[model samples]
Target: MALPIVAMTLSSCGRAPELRVNDAVVILSPVDSNPAALYFTIHGGPEKVYLNSVLSRSVIRSEVHESKVDPKTGMVTMEPTRKIEIPAKGTVEFKRGGKHVMLWGVNRPARQLKELEAEFIFSNGDRIIVDAEVRAATAGDADKKDAHSGH
Candidate 1:
């Protein structure tokens, strides 16, 4: 009599190797706009990740911006931030009313926003490059709400 072999496949839910992003979108601001913001959602990780900086040819300068609200004054302002942390096995969002990328001093008039590319520099020496699409400035609210809800 031949014995039947039993085989089992185990599924693993182990955390992803490192940090990553999803639903990444950049709303290209109109030409001549200064200090435009970029929003997106970052996912994945077994350890914490930080956003180091952002780079693009569309602007003269790039910086990380964090939005803070004054409880007493009921005012909001964006200021340069050191690093935005992404928790382990978790996610981080760059959204309006929160954190975002500030691109300043757009030099040329973006006709139809022909070339919009952004390089996301991560603290772990990882780079995620994304091409942003041209969108109307008025659509910021919709984009912000969608980003806040985790894209």
Candidate 2:
């Protein structure tokens, strides 16, 4: 007589999550109302994301900007960047006191909270469209549903 045998198998049933970005905030100072700054964090995907360009109707132009803090001179300077690479499985945070987006030439005042259309052009030929809410400078105006929220 032979004993019966039993076996079990397991498998994954869902597609892997795609690369994305979150918590995109564009801050417009009261002084330089025309030109605004953008800050956001990029979520998972590949090792890096090439930010081709940024678009908005409210502003004439949008560019990636970075800040340089000099320890010796105790001075901080900022300049325009061609593109930004968001690390894969990592996080790229664009904060107020750090690297951000520079939006120039605003004809109207961005006082009230409004949804501004922004299409992020990537080197991979992928477009990530985000609705940026225009509010006060100090206001926490970041996307909550984005992957960057949990972190």
Candidate 3:
């Protein structure tokens, strides 16, 4: 009985942190555009996680951002966020009109290619790489449809 208990403990200790991104996408912009937004769902691991930053070869810089709406003004604004915390066994979603990754100074090739690789860096030194699909800004209907469907 003691041996079995010890084995279980060891198994639990060996569990590594896991991060997963679902339905990752980048919104397409014009040829000389300097800014774009990336959206996805980040599934957390067994431990609490912090999203430090986003990296992409297609962009000169990337930052995390959250959308805020003013009640009186009835206007929506995007604000820069330093980091995002995801609860253990939970998920953080970056969606349209919500939290998202902002990419600045995007290159022409990235816009034409319609595909790019994004890397998510975590406070725990864990990195997750994902391929993001590019879609036109006019595809709001399709984006909404995909958001509602289960990934």
Question: TM-score per candidate, in order?
Answer: 0.74, 0.73, 0.76
Ranking by TM-score: 3, 1, 2
The parts of candidate 1 lying over 4 Å away from their true place are 1-9, 13-18, 28-31, 106-115, 139-151
Kindly provide the TM-score of model 2 when superposed on the true structure, using C-alpha atoms: 0.73
What is candidate 1's CA lDDT for residue 141? Answer: 55
Kindly list the per-residue Cα lDDT of model 3 for residues 1-151, writing each as its tens digit. 7999999988888665567787999875433454677999998998998999989998998889887778998777778889999888798999877898888776667667888889999989999999898766675544543221221
What is the full ranking by lDDT, best candidate first? 3, 1, 2
Query: Top model by lDDT, which number?
Result: 3
Candidate number with greatest TM-score: 3
Per-residue lDDT tens digits of candidate 2, residues 1-151?
Answer: 2222222222334455466767876665555544667677777575566776788777887777777677898666677789888666667788755677877764464435555667888777888888776654443544312221221
C-alpha local distance difference test of each model: 0.66, 0.65, 0.78
Q: Give the clashing residue pairs of candidate 1, or none.
A: none
* Cα error of candidate 2 at position 71, Å: 2.9
Show model 2 residue runs off by greater than 4 Å.
1-14, 32-34, 107-113, 138-151
Model 1 over residues 1-151: C-alpha lDDT tens digits?
2333322222334435667665555554544453566777888577777888888877788788777778998767667888888777787888778888776654455435544678888788889887765444565454553222221
